[model samples]
Target: MDPNEHSNRLSTEFISLVEKINTLSNRTRSSEQPFLGALEQWRIESQQTLDSFCNEKRQTFINSRLEELNRLRTNVEELACVQDVTQQNTNSIKTSIDRIEQDINKIQFNFRPLLIDEHLIVRRSQDLLPFPPSNQAIELTDSSYAVLAGNKQHLLVHREPTLCLLDRQLTIIKETSWPLDDISDICWSSVLNRFIVINSQYVFILDERTMVLEQCLTSDTVNWIRGTCSDTKLYLSTEGIGSSIFEYTLMPSIVLLKEWKSPVTCAHNEWIEDLKFHNDFLGLVIGRCKNNAVCFELRSTVTLNCLWSIQLEEVCSMYATRCCPMLNHQWIVVAFRNPRIFHISSGGKLISADKKCRSPSNICQIGSNLLAIWDQKCIYLQNLCCII
Candidate 1:
């Protein structure tokens, strides 16, 4: 039987036992369905209110302007019939014209087209990914691995046996073993054209062309769990609760630039599981040590202030979670314990709750068209056309 089978069955039975009657409030508290339904109703009501207001104001505008319009027409008819211009009639016509112009301007402002954009109209979809992948799932030779795509040219993966640099087709171009200690997380530095790997406090750079791994020792001590890079900065997350995140320079040499402590990095009791950098912002996946409560926050890289945050799960067993940057300024977060995938919008809203039927451990978007998913059984490299 599956490891969680018993728990799943018991939970379902317990839910059935206590569900005497389905009340709106109780059901609403535990699930988002009711709130979503309410939001739809609210939107409909809001649109109806707007339509009613516009229609009422429109009729009122027409009613108020009809008398002025009639007077203007009468004055024009009278002026045309006179044919000869006198100062008194000329002044009267000028006054009527001025009033009509002002009325027209007000009418134009009130009757303008609706102000809305494609961004607001685009509906959020819970579309399952792979969208039937451009190609089949390329099950890798290794059961478990670390895969990352920084450049469009190559993909990197490390297993217990060796570190492999594969081409876009997921074919191994070159392979190497760790020079010193085992590297934990891998990040790509586009500016450097290199991959940065972390082994706790130690830092290393690997060249895919020759498959060589070398250390760039900062000689500092901390629990570095994950690493990701921007054009200029290298961001690393720590392990254990109240974990800290360190920022380093990718310039002259790998040097400490700044340190983000607890409460700044995350709540004092929570830890950062994964982090990704995109468009001058850092995305942090914060998790708890005791339960499966997880949060994905988008923050400003300049000030480290949270722009927005979303709670992915309320209670889950401590499991590894990963965040990948997808096309169109969005995120893909996968929780390994429950084997579920969450697609998030660039604005920190949960776009979809896609459930993965496999026991996949982690996933990554390799460039624009490819996605890599790895587990204890195998690795899957699918197309990202629709996933994004």
Candidate 2:
């Protein structure tokens, strides 16, 4: 090589090394300091987790006490039935008294003050604006409908002629046309790493990575309305009165696991508009056919037995009701026909409700602290708050 060429090459290499070193210095902020900052953030998050765990335990303890008291009351009531009008044998009376006494003793023990860390509590924000925050929304075509949260920080949306994948910021990543019609609902199957899309008669799976769509012949032919998925199972509900929910396995094929129908699903006159599964429980929205009487029910996914039911208003609508999972096993639901949003506990208790938003049709939590809500024409992104 020429002497001048070698000298220029050495000079270029030296400059490049210095630039790389500067970049590393900027990224690490002197190595140990950046790591220490990250450690502090993790510590704060760990404390938050501990606080939440303590809160849940306190609630569980209270619920157990209430259940035990109910049992004791029932036992006493039965003991009172020892009226001569009703024949109560000596053995039966003794057994009832023993049961009541045992329950009373247990209740007395639990009635004592609990020693726990009650540091974490949720409160409604002072500026609880029920409308879209900062008007951060994306407009869609008139034919667009339905939005669902995917595994990553992305969303699946259906428009008139195509299906689109969007990031948390409501920016479209890709759109494809597989010619689907009457798209009822879409759910992400974490086990399959794909999306399960349901219409009235067919089930489709879309690969989020490739944006490819395909039909699942294994799915049953039914009038499907809305759907939700667990890690291992895909659950779809039907479209009419006395709507039935079908459970299918996520492996091998979308094979049938169990088919739940009314009154196990809901009363004969009620419609199953929306359903979501969180952990071991299933949340259902059942609406009366002829009127606007709607109820949110929590049930066991294993036994399909009702756990608790809470009455709600202005939710059942021309569009199916929505149920999105919230942190700590809570749910955020919407009133589509009217403009109302609700926060509910895992045990079917109303935490709070916002009588704002204009014609809110659907809602889904995008990431941990962000929320995505949509109506007919636009989708809004907002900072999620745990409103009391």
Candidate 3:
């Protein structure tokens, strides 16, 4: 009764103790699983943070290097332009030197001695030359020589942010300050009796009499090179990937008609230098590198058909072109480098040339004479022709 019962009871108690220990171990294992999961999640988040920081640093370095390279490239391009201009000036000086040398050689070899006591009186007369007398000139403040436009009665001059209307005597009759950012070019429309002013982004129409801003028009393309207006439409020259002319009708509602591009093959880098319109013809002065310029005339309407084209020579710079209405034959005045003026026929023939004006930038017909601005400061009134 004593030994067997005691041994059985001890065995049962040992078995119970084993069951309780197993339950405690299972609970401890379950609790440790959640802690281990939380620890693993923390480790993963730390790794992601470190990776993101490293990527950010790498991208920043790359962007900084790209910006620096772009700046350097811009500087190099500027240097190249300066070098080209320097070379051009050097060549110009060399040509002048050669001309002077040739003149000296002619004087040395083919000298003609003047007769003594013979009075040689050179008669001065306006009939001898085509240019009119330099009657009036007025200096302006930082004016662009390319901003001369108008008819025979009034001359419109743009002095940046301001426009000046002058009389035949080169006196400023009216002055109006432009409210826009800048003005790239200006033209007068006799039919609309308004002045068209253009910037790179917008075109502004102004009343001729009151000189008040009338209407503003915008274009999809940027960089408007020049503008011209007819009786019923306005023509704009815009330059981007290529050169193009955008036409807008000036009726009840301003409507975009169409865009015109030159059918003539042009280099991808070609740009428009100047634009002019006369009668039913539109003239475009296109330029590339120095001495690479072409004058083209096409139909002034939406349907562009090339009538004539002429490549210009000895033109270091081509700035502006104007159609002359007083002449019987179609003639346009083209201003070239060193401010030389050339009369070009519609058929591309080089007519009379004038190099008397210093740094002529623009030309227009005023009365029976040609009015031109020189060096962005002085204005000259010269006869269109001296022959009777």
- Candidate 2 stretches with Cα past 4 Å from truth are 1-132, 218-221, 385-388
- Please give each candidate's TM-score: 0.63, 0.65, 0.60
Residue lDDT tens for model 3, 1-388: 6999999999999999999999888876773664455546766987898799879977875676566556555655676678456666556556655665565467443436634332321222223124555767777667443576777688888765578888878788888987766677888776667778787887777776898876577766567878877777878887543677778887765678877765432345676666677666666666656554545444535455567666666554535444343343455554546555666655666666667746666666665455554455666776444322
lDDT of every predicted structure (CA atoms): 0.73, 0.76, 0.65
lDDT by residue (3-36, candidate 2, tens digit) is: 9999999999999999999988788775357345
Off by over 4 Å in 3: 1-133, 143-145, 262-267, 296-302, 316-326, 367-370, 385-388
Worst 10 residues of 3 by lDDT: 120-129
The segments of candidate 1 whose C-alpha lies over 4 angstroms from its true place after superposition are 1-147, 289-291, 314-318, 386-388
Residue 60 in candidate 2 has what lDDT? 85
What is the per-residue lDDT of model 1 for residues 287-308, given as tens digits with 9 covering 90 to 100? Answer: 8754457888898998889999
Ranking by lDDT: 2, 1, 3
Q: Pick the candidate with the highest TM-score.
A: 2
Clashes of each: 1, 1, 0
- Per-candidate Cα RMSD to the true structure, in Å, reads 16.6, 22.8, 36.0
